[model samples]
Target chain A: MDVLLVEDDYYLADDTRRVLAAAGANVAGPYARVAESLSRVAQGRVDCGVLDINLGEGPSFIMARALKQRDVPFVFATGYGREVLPDDFNEVELLEKPVDPRLLIDAVARACRKHETSEV
Target chain B: MATLAGAMNGPGADRLSALPWEQTPLGPRAGWPGSLRAAIDLMLGAGAPCALFIGPQLVQMHNLAFDALYRDGSAATRALGRSLKRDDPDSSLAKAAGEVFAGRSILLASQGWTIGASPGTPAFNLSCAPIRDESGQVGAMLVLAFPVTSPARLDAGASISELQHRVRNLLAVVRSLVARSAESSDTVEDLAAHLDGRIAAVARVQGVLLRNPHAGVDLEGMIRDELLTQSADQDRLNLGGPEIVLPPKAADLMTLAIHELATNATKFGALSQASGKLDITWKLDQAGARGQQLELVWMELGVAIASQAPRRQGFGTNLLKRRLPYELSGEADIEFRPGGVVCRIAFPLAPVAAMGSSSVWGVTTTAGDDA
Candidate 1:
């Protein structure tokens, strides 16, 4: 399983990477900036992605839009409440920050599983 | 002119004579018109803040009461002989003086005027009338000013509004802290201790913010304050970082995260032993596409093997690993090295101006680092 990770916080990204790796998913590009993450999304090889909404440069909505266009499944892992999420992304899954490791693993697994079902 | 000399010889006579009014637009008093001299006598003898703006230039001649109103003596002295038009272009006094010069008497009941940007700006009420010569032409503008009682209350409503907003946000943060702290604790004692520490961290940030309400809290200073509270001997800890001002929310979150790290080091990490050492260093990474990013590293050295794996997944671990990244839009890498724990964190440093006004909830993609 190939999972895309986009988070600017080094510690949280590494922690999420460890959890995903342990779940047997190959984490790709925990890209810290929006531009780099968008470039990785353009490659189209990611099975799933976990994104932080605010990337310091700005929000990751552009990257989310690109993923949505490609039919790739992703979840928002952020500290902000759901009210802060864009109205357009109302259907997407959101895991608030200080995420439980188990919850993160389930979100990624579910995203990857959903992607597989949609492709099949 | 003799009567004008008599007025000057009265109370505050020496101080009035000491002023170099001879070089002013009015010139020597001996050459003054009779109408102007009589007006000066009336103004000098009055027990109120009064001033005479003479001629079309509106050259200023004020009484001692007016000088005491100025907090800065140099500012008061600097105003002497200068035209009111040049001294305060947009002030009510200037505007009223203009109207009085045009032969219209204006009585302002309670117009407000702030002296400066100092914490407490003194406010005043002013009134003015045109002083005419014996020939009936308006020769000068006579102005009277009185200090407003309880001027602080004049601006209290606005301050109270902002204060209410801040207090609400702080309460929300505290609620979140309490909930999160409870989730990671194993026992009641653990929860109590953890909640106390987290609340203290929030309070510390609040203290710094209150001291300098306009400027944000300093990053290095916050970390040092948190670390010092945990460790008795400062020699065991080494901290190095450039000065960075964090927005209120960022400062609060960072203080909690630092507190967590220091607590871990004290209980089951490097600081658990006397020989243990801790080094924390940070630097700005400016080559990012969006804006400057801050990369901070925390490395613990000389920890006993027993302290390496103390509860693998706890509140401290979750906070460092998840909360920081989610809240700050930063990255974190926590590794249990052979010697001790090594945590590296990276987050974008939003320009200071954007931190307070910009909706912490609003997401935008603007790339300019205006700081």
Candidate 2:
């Protein structure tokens, strides 16, 4: 499974990539901004993704919406609670920060599992 | 006015008499109308802070409590018996007084008023009611001024500053966690696991605190939250305890401690296996002098453990034993048994009433609980 990780914090992003890599998922660019991450999501062969809702500039709801349009499964990793998320993304998996490493790995795996099950 | 003779007996009566009323448009007190005299009497008699701007000239007559509003040297003395138009023309009090003079009774709430040359502009909730004479005309305007800003505003400002300070401290804590985790891990994967676990612990604490900002954190709820984050199988974990509210300081420290324990269990302790079991129980030792002391025990069962403890102390051990003790004034005993890890923590609970009455004690699990 190839996972795209979008997070603004460099340290947290690096850590997340490492966790996913260890969990046997092929990790893509750990993009630091919405524009870069959005382009990566468009260009890369991403199976699923882990997204941070707040990208320092604004929310990543647009990214989530874009992924949803492409029928992609993704999980939100945020410091803020679910109340800040849009109504449309309510069914999307949310992982509150600091995300437990086990939970993070499990969520990305689950996202991939859901995608695979749906495709079959 | 009725010769200012017997009327000079109430509060602020001496100040009222001492003022140069003869120099104002209302002229001497001896020649003032009966309505004006009655208004002055009523203003001085009240204990609460209030002022009366009498007649069309809007002359000022306030009580003793109202005097504090004009404590700036000459401003207090200069304001007495003077026309609102003549004294501080740009003030909200002057503007509100003008509206009252136009036969309108206005109640101004939390209105800012800059008194004299003072830089601090305090808020005042004032009501300007038009006092009618015997002929049914708007005779004297009775102005009631109540200081509204000091207590409430001071509290809000303090809370905001405290929140900012806490956020800065939390950020510093995150920075330290990342740096420390990097030092211990050999590979990037190891570093991510360590750093993410610690950061998640801090975030969990923040979530609990943010939910019930006024009240202390719920002990049972916090423990369950930490455990639920590590695994989806709730059947393996048995958490039983009465509702325990911990002070913010204790809650923050305990969250990290519990996280460390849970992380260790998931990796190598009870939760590492399919048939593994975990039991968390806590009770209050209410015999303490100040308040109840909480004794919590986390016992991991049905899993094989290492024969010996680690050679060196890790973050989990340091947080439970050293950090917990230093920060929350508590003690923790973590032992690696042959079966699984057993940890015991004891801390003095702050008085229930002091923890704040307005706090909602609802159990708020993370988003993963539903998943």
Candidate 3:
């Protein structure tokens, strides 16, 4: 599975990227802004995504909505509470910050597998 | 201590019946104001604990329920005829009652009553209402006390949990910092230096944030402190800027970036040379599309071109060129001139403030090219 990581905080972004890469999944561009990620998502190699809501400017809900339309599953990595997410994205998986590597990988596998089985 | 017969009922009434009513500041019972008379009647008829503060002195009178609150001694009864306005003026009840006396009825969620100075005294929920005379002039205060539920303990528990959540979030960020520091280091020593310096920079910012939780760190102070520790002499630096306060997250990243730059200068740039100069300056750029932007420039001169940049494009370079842009939604430019290295960073500053006509951090044009 290919996982696209989008986060602004460099340490968390770099560290999360390492964790996802180590789990044997191909990782896409760890883009910083919405425009950058939105363009990358349009090209279509991404299977799953791990997005941080607050991208310095605003939450990545714009990207989240796009992913939803594409039928791709993803987890939200946030230091903030659930109120930060809207009602539409409430059911999506949430990964709390300083994310545990094993949990992150498992969440990705589950997200991808979830979509796969529903199709089956 | 003869037949005193106060205008009330209850143990407090019994206590008032025993006191020499005509002698104290309260004066004789019949001579009491009509407001006091009515207030006493209302307090005694209450099902819960109640106190009446009467007259200009605001002397206290209570019912059996109010007297029962202090079970150890007759302290609550003794407190009768003591002035809530004057006797224990600093007391919480007195303060609330003062408002009632001012013709405003105040219902408090919780208040401390000086029934006894003894420890483990429970807090009371007090409701103070204005008691007016027959002439419609405010003359007394009627205070009702509810059962104690130990809300202070509950509030402390909530604050502790809030504190715990914050600590855990902070720990997570630190954990990520540890891994990132390790990733950029080429060797064990490099890792230690990178980790220690980055951690210390974070600690410095954390200290400022803790001291002033609302207002953030001043940009000028950050640059001075960061470079001073790098042993860059005061005379070798030209620091200028309009005072800019960076919010917590921005402060953390900026401080780290400054640390990286200072460390590089100390090792190879201006600070390492005998006749070198380092100019650190910043200004608020108001005319940007993204509200206000703060632009900072770190320039060094008099050091050799070989040591201008770190051998590897490590933490400092990546932070200035890449991480800063991603995290701050900003821009950065790092140029290694033959004589030194120059780095310019710009980011949006929130709560766009307009100060007196902005001061220019004069660019020292003489040293940019000593090649």
lDDT of each structure?
A: 0.72, 0.71, 0.73
The most accurate candidate by TM-score is: 3
lDDT per residue for candidate 2 within B243-319, as digits (tens), equals 88776667777887788888888888788888678999999897556356788999988886453465668877776
Best by DockQ: 3
Q: Candidate 2 lDDT (Cα, whole model)? A: 0.71
Query: What does DockQ give for each predicted structure?
Result: 0.04, 0.01, 0.18
Candidate 2, residues A31-109, lDDT tens digits: the string is 7656676788778668887987654322437778778888889999876566556688887788867678898888877
Q: Quote model 2's TM-score for chain B.
A: 0.74
Q: Summarize candidate 3's per-residue lDDT along B1-371 as a digit string, tens digits.
A: 21243455544466766677677778877676656766777788788989878777778778877765564556776777677666677777777766777799887764335456443444466778887888988787888887555332323333343344345456777887777677688899988887888888888988996775446688899888898778789999999889888866688889999998898788888888887799888888885567678899988888775674556777777777777777777789988887788989999765411111011122121111101
Question: How many Å off is the CA of A25 in candidate 1?
Answer: 29
Model 1 iRMS (Å) reads 8.1
A33 Cα displacement, candidate 3 (Å): 4.8
Off by over 4 Å in 3: A1-4, A21-46, A53-71, A80-91, A118-120, B1-169, B286-288, B304-308, B350-371
Scanning candidate 2 chain B in windows of ten residues, the lowest lDDT window is B362-371
Residue B96 in candidate 1, Cα distance off native in Å = 13
